[model samples]
Every structure is written in C-alpha cells, then in structure tokens.
Target: MSANQLNYSVSNAGAFSDFASVTEGMLKGKIFLKDGLQLTSMEVSLNHLPPKGEVPFYHKHQQNEELYIFLQGQGRIQVDGNEVDVHEGTSIRIAPDGVRALRNTSATQGLHFIVIQAKENSLTQWVETDGIILDQPVEWITRSSCLK
Candidate 1:
C-alpha cells in the first residue's frame, strides 16, 4: 500500500479563541496558509465593520458563491433588490450575479460572523454599492441603518 504526505502547524491557536482586541475596528483576517495547512475550508472571522462598516458597497460575483454565517451580533442583508434582517445563528446564502451588502446597526456591540467563500477562483465583490456614488471613498457608517 502507498502512503500519502501531509504536514501542518497550529495557526493562531489552532482553533477559535476570544476575539477581543485582535478583532477591534475593521475586519481582520488570519490566513492559515503560512501555517502549512491545505485550503480545506474557506473561512473568515469578522469582527467590527471590517474596514467599511455601515457603508458596504453593493457588488456581484464574477465566478464565486458566498455565504455569511452570523456567529454573533446582528445586521441586515440586502440581496437582489430585497432586504433581509439577519441575526445570530443565521446563515445567509448568496449566489452569483446577486446583489448583496451588510450593515451593522448596533451602537457599542459589533457584528461577529464567518464568511465562507464556497467557490474557487472567486473573491468578494464590492465594486458598486447600491447607493454609493462610486467616485467618493466611503468614510464610515454614517447612516444608522441600511437604506435599501
């Protein structure tokens, strides 16, 4: 019988830990690549607004499917001209060419969730948000909640 070859290391504690200071303001992601692990699963632990909090641009996928699993916190989901409220323990699936965006309405509390890009050669698309002017850079979540 032949044997397979595989080796890896513990990445930033190997598993999930208390994301207090690590995930402060914008969205922070820790890649497990340098840790020497295969890309078995596509996962991201999102804390805070993840760079562009309230004003997330609306865009579509070129060739990938995405899903946002709300581990904790609350937010609203806008898809294909429809808006859906998302909360903890909720998994929202988005398809290609589908319009999508999320906004955090909490005051002090932040939204914690895992982004699962279930498609290969596909990346998160936020090129043209719904109401965003597309020329000006979004400062921060100036609005209380999502418009659409």
Candidate 2:
C-alpha cells in the first residue's frame, strides 16, 4: 500500500537509510512525520541498527517520554546508568529526563525496533474509558454470529 492512505500511513523501516548514516544527536530512524502521517500528539519512528553497532551518545528529551519496542535481534539499553538486555518483544519506557543509549549486541543480526514518543502525563483516558462500544456489526463477522 502507499505510505499515506485514507486515514493512516504505512511504511517499512527499510525504506529509511541505515542508522549509521544518521548524524550525531539526531533521531536514528524513519520518522513518520516525513511520510505525511499528520500526527498531532505523538511521534513514531522505525529504527534499525547494524549488528554490533551502538548509539554513539547518550541523550535525553526535555518534555517527551519515549517507549522503545524491540522487534528483532538482541540488544542492550541503558537508562541512567542501568542496563537491561532486550530482544524480540522486549519493551522499555523512559521518562523525559532519563538519559538513555542503546546498543546492538548480536554478532551477526541487526536490531530492529520502534520508538514512540509523547508528552509525559498527557494521556487522560485509557482503553476502558476512551473507547465506546458501537452497535454496528463488523463486516468480517458473520451476521448469524452477532445474535450469540
């Protein structure tokens, strides 16, 4: 599908240049902003790190907290001097002021991850309170099943 569709956008991480090509102190991923995603409250990026590579510097944000989700390979993330091992399915959340750095520890596999950033303490509602049940039936579900 095209990067920007009806109400959403989709793009692969591989579409962006390698992390090694990113300049120092810059975000090391394909930010959705450049894809015309029209995001207003948060920023998302798809990141890939070469095997045995590491972010050259530790950094922190001033107002945006970050969540890192590891999707492939092995890695280590350091936050405020504490290190944690991460691999596929691993996730870590860091507050705005928490200094953080990452490294790809695998000898032969690249690290694939996603980073989501948003203003801290900005969420006022969660799934239970924010979502409303709709009476409309889903197209994928059989009509007879709705009666059950």
Candidate 3:
C-alpha cells in the first residue's frame, strides 16, 4: 500500500463517541480513526468520564507503552498501585509493564484526557512536557493474556 493510504487524520470534534461500563465507571470514548487510518503499533483515543467515574481494571501491556495527557477537570491515576493526582496540563507516561488505571474525581466537570499507546521501546518526543523524550528499549514479559 502507498504511504498515503496509511496516513489519515480526524478532528476531535468530528469523531464519533462510544460508551463502555467498567469496574471504575462509565467511559465515553472517541477512538482516533483506528479502522480508517489502519494504524500499526500505535493507538490513540480521547476519554471522558463523568464525576466519580473510573476505569475498572489495572491493566498492563506487554508490547505497548502508554501516555496520558489530562485535558480537563481532575482525576486520579493509579500506577503500579500508587495513586497520583492528575488534572488539566498533567501528563503521565507508563511503561509496558506498569499496571495503571484512572478515576474521574471531579464533582461538576468531566474528566477528559488523551491517551496514546505505541510499541515498547519506541522513540517518543513531546514538544511540551519539557520536551520529554523516551528512547530506551525494554524486553517486557506478559503477565497474562491481554484483554484489549
């Protein structure tokens, strides 16, 4: 396939939403053109949670690393069993083996965040977040079968 066939983009405002209920709470999610774009080794989405909503499970990836950038309201992210506060402007990076989950703690506003997942050991650079970069490679062993 041509490279042009592999490249596609969508605006958040134009994306369609999907809903899921998990142990944490109700999730209103908008996937970033996964089917249409035919992405490989990467995934992106926007998640919005009402007050007191949360992701039900602590999940880990064996081949993919994840990054979450908080966009609105407030929430708590549990990473490796530790709960950390997150709000607008907060960014988090989770390696493939790190167990992670999220909860929306905001009472009046929704908790909105952008999630990006890429293959483990991939080079990632952020213009913001102090120009953060990740370049180290890791050989991750799966804890169990992935349910993703």
Candidate 4:
C-alpha cells in the first residue's frame, strides 16, 4: 500500500465555550478558523449573535468578497445601506466594496452563522474541472472496526 499522505486539522469550537462567552472585542461570539486550521486561501469564521445583538460596525473590504451562511435563528443584514432579512439556511454573497453590517433581530433566539472571505474574482475552476475522480476501489468501514 502507498504511504499515508494527508494533512489536516480539526477543532471543536464548542471546546472554547458558547459563542457569547467571549467578552473582549468587537468579534465577540465569533471564532476564526483560518488561524486554527492554518488555511492559506480563505478566512472563515463561525459566529453567534445573542438576541437583539449586532455586528457593531459597518465595513467594506478592499479586495475580498464575503459569503455569509446562516444556520440558525433570524436576523437582518444591511448591504450598502439596504437591509434585508435573513434566517436559517440563508446564504448571501457580498462583493468586496459593499458596505455591510448585521444584527440578530430575534427577541429570544440567538443567531448562528458562518462567514467565508476570499479574493474577489479569483475562482478559475469549479468542481467539474478542478476535481479529479480517482480510479480506486470503494470500501466501506464499519463503526466496529474503528474501535479496533
């Protein structure tokens, strides 16, 4: 068999406690994945906003576009002065120069979401062209085998 050749990093954000446990900065309730995962191409953050909470400031990026993916609760996001409601399963892509801010509007539930930032107009290939299908056998591993 070929030598195992793979590199990866895994972390549980919950190990740091609930998102709202952070009390020091504008990035409260947020955890950055880039530093922890040593990612080279993009920045990713997991966020949770307490009820009626907000992002604290409106900002724009110089060259990176952002994608926001909402996972729980409800909220609103303002882009370039226009506000739109968002909820679980909502996904939005904002261009580099679009001014943006967000808030959790739910009166009782917290908002959970993820944001991914990457260079604008940098994707030259997608799954169809960028991924290679290996001609290898498909083997299913049983849970019992994992313990051994």
Candidate 5:
C-alpha cells in the first residue's frame, strides 16, 4: 500500500464527546482528520444544530464544494439566496462559489447532518486512478456505538 493510502477504516459518528464548537448551541465533529484517512481531500463532519439556531453567516468556498446530507430533524438551506426545505435523507450539493447557510427551522426538533467538503474538480480521478472501484457492491458493517 502507498504511504498515503488508508486501509479500510470505520468510525462511530454518533459519539459526541469530542466536538468543536462552531457557535453557541452548534457543534461539529471532524471525522476525516480524526481517522487519518488520505483517501480524499474531502472534509467530513457531523454537525449538530439546536432548534431555531442557524449558521452564523453566509459563506462561500473559493476552492471547495460542499455536500450536506441531513440525517435528522428539519431545516432550510439557503444557497445563493434561494431557500429549500431539508429533512432526513435530504442531500444538497453546493458549488464552490455559491454562498450558503443553514438554519434549523423546527421549533422542537434539533438538526443533525453530515457535511462533506472537497476541492472542486477533484473527484473524477477516484475512478480513473482506481482509488475507488465503481462496479463493486458496497459493504456495510457496524461499529461499536461507544467510541472513546
């Protein structure tokens, strides 16, 4: 294996002990860096947003695009001033230059989601370079829920 390659790895994303405070009432756990995975330049994280809270400000990535996969609760994501409702299983891919922000709109339900961010125009090589095989069936396995 190449020095940069990471063998198969797993993480229990629900354990919230180690979290970075994004804002008051909002926190995120960086899973990619924590796992030491060099598979992609992507940044992966699980974010928690309290009800009625929102991202502090609209922002845009100059070189990285972002994909948000909502896992629970209800929210609205505004991309370039266009708002769209989001719920469990909702996914949104935003261009690197698109201004974006998220808000937890549910009065009682907190929001939880995964965000994967990576540089624009950098993903195709995963297939061309055989970094990821496209034809194989995906494998699913469970990890212990309590990870310290």
Candidate 6:
C-alpha cells in the first residue's frame, strides 16, 4: 500500500464507481485501498442506493455502533418505532443494538448514504431486554422448552 490519503478528490475511484447493490452494508468502496487505517483511526467509504432501496430487515447488533450520513436523494429512516424523513445532509446513527431501517422515498432519484460501522465483533448477540420477544414463534419455543 502506498502512503496515500483517503481524500476522494485525490483518489482515482471514479464517480458512481462504488456501487453497493445490497440494501445495507457496513462499508462500501473499492475492496482494496492504500490507507492502512486502523479501527481506532476509522475509515470512510461512499455508498449507493437504488430506487426504493431499503436497508436489511430490522435488527440489532451486539457491540457495533453505526452511523449513516445521507449525501443524496430523499428517504425515510425508521428507528425503534419512530419514522423520520431523510435527505441530503441528514446524519443518523444506530447505537450498539438500536433497531433501525432506511428506505428510499424519492420517485425520480436514487438514495445515497455514507455508512460507517465502528469496530465491533459483529456478533448478532440476541438477548430479550425486559423479557421482550418480538418473534411470537420464538417466544413460544422458549416457553415450551422450559415446560418440557
């Protein structure tokens, strides 16, 4: 890796180059780079969203902290149970286990947001806070297990 800076203006990654097809990802950019940045230092990558782009099924993480900075188009963000508007210049974050989702709401434009996931094990650790279980089937399974 060369002793290079991550300033996109200086990097050769062409515009509309880092296309992230999936609904959501922790990072989106050229897979290999010369930054050699560390987790403590953190890194940034640009992202793309197709029309009607929606993030992965709502879920939470065990230890990861994430942030989304909207750079283009219009959209909506649902966090925990609150839905809010999103658009260029909107900044959002999901603390460790916060339930959140992003949805593109524009008709003629595609949504784009820069996402950064902080250093985390990325282990989907599941635990019911306040004995809450949203999945009724799973709740039933657990109750049956204890009775058996």
Question: Which has the greatest TM-score?
Answer: 4
User: How does model 5 score by TM-score?
Assistant: 0.68
Q: What are the clash counts of all predictions, listed in order?
A: 4, 0, 2, 0, 0, 0
Model 5 has a clash total of: 0
Residue-level lDDT tens digits of model 1 in 1-148: 1122455333332322244345333434322231143346453433444322453478778766777777656678799989887778999878867888777666665666666665654545555643455687667764766232
* Order by TM-score, highest first: 4, 2, 5, 3, 6, 1
> What's the CA error at residue 7 for candidate 6, in Å?
14
Highest-scoring model, lDDT: 4
- For 28-145, candidate 4 gives per-residue lDDT tens digits of 8888888677788899888889999898888999999999999999999999999999999999999999999999999998999989999999989989999999999999899886
lDDT of 5: 0.72
Tell me the alpha-carbon RMSD of every candidate: 19.1, 6.1, 13.2, 4.6, 6.2, 19.5
lDDT of each: 0.57, 0.79, 0.71, 0.85, 0.72, 0.62
Q: Write down the worst ten-residue block by lDDT for model 6.
A: 27-36
* 50-122: candidate 6 lDDT, tens digit per residue: 6776766787767667777888889998888899898989998778768987787876777776667665555
TM-score of 2: 0.78
Q: Which whole-number lDDT from 0 to 100 does residue 67 have in model 3?
A: 89
Candidate 1 achieves a global lDDT of 0.57
- Count residue pairs with overlapping backbones in model 4: 0
**3 or 4, greater by TM-score:** 4
Candidate 4 versus the native: TM-score?
Answer: 0.86
1 against 5, candidate with superior TM-score: 5
Instruction: List model 2 lDDT by residue over 1-148, tens digit each.
Output: 2366577765444443365465423645434543456677898777878888787899999999999998888999999999999999999999999999999999898888888999999999989999999999776767876422
lDDT score of residue 26 within candidate 4 = 62
Spell out the clash pairs found in candidate 6. Answer: none
lDDT of 3: 0.71
Off by over 4 Å in 3: 1-7, 11-27, 30-32, 124-148
